[model samples]
Target: MVCVFAIALLLLGPNPAKAESREQAVDRLTDYLFYRVNSQLNNRKLQTDDREYIRQWQRLREAIDPRVKSVQEVCLRVSPQEKGWEFTTINGETYEQTYDRLADTIFYSRHPQRTGQPIPTNDKIGISEWSAIRREMFLSNCGL
Candidate 1:
């Protein structure tokens, strides 16, 4: 009975190198993105010059690396509209963006270049553009 229990424990134990499921992996990535973005915004609001937010963002970026392939394949498989606050890849880089109707502002770590006109505020933009900005921000800031 002890031997059987030990075998069962080994079977149930964690595997450090195991790949996470798509949902689990994306969820992890999303949490990291959310935390980093929120912290940066909050710090900005407080008028603090803290750089701790950058460290948090880096941690999230590292977490997403292992799950990139899975995330890319899943993104291709799903409809764009159906993808919510999850990690998706563009140009072989992983990024986190949400598409909920209630989201008022989109956050990006990196600012994009514009040709002539200034970039419109989040409330005035389309979803596609917003998502593209999010990806660009992730790539620029998260070191992806």
Candidate 2:
């Protein structure tokens, strides 16, 4: 059903005289890509484990940018094989982020280069090396 709607919308692009807003486009994109019941972000409705991951990411953002007063909204960019989230402020800055719950690590592209080394190709970061990169990102990008 969503695929059908998406195809129709694409075939008939937004009215040239009046464009759809950014939020509308994102909502449409989410629907087109995934089929699921809309999930709410209420903390009381979440499991303990799920809440812990949320806390971790919240802490990460604070460590990165303490001046961020409030987050207006979040959007998830999902694929069948992987998932990530985007946080946006009212001021229009977006932080595209992904978290690995098992490894307890977060990846964001704010700082592409790892400290003290040339960025490597085909890098696979896991628990062992997460600390170094985490520290590098915190110091360089996050205000920590």
The pairs that clash in candidate 2 are 64-142
Candidate 1: where is the Cα deviation over 4 Å?
1-18, 40-136, 139-144
What's model 1's lDDT at 136?
36
Best by lDDT: 1
Pairs in steric clash, model 1:
none
Q: Rate the local accuracy (lDDT) of all candidates.
A: 0.44, 0.35
Who wins the TM-score comparison? 1
Query: 22-132 in candidate 2: lDDT tens per residue?
Result: 444444333321111112343234357765445544444443242222112232333444322222334443332321211122333223244234335456553335544
lDDT per residue as tens, model 1, 49-137:
53444543444455454444432345445554442333444445423322221012333323223323345666455445545434434
Ten-residue segment with the worst summed lDDT in candidate 1?
Answer: 97-106
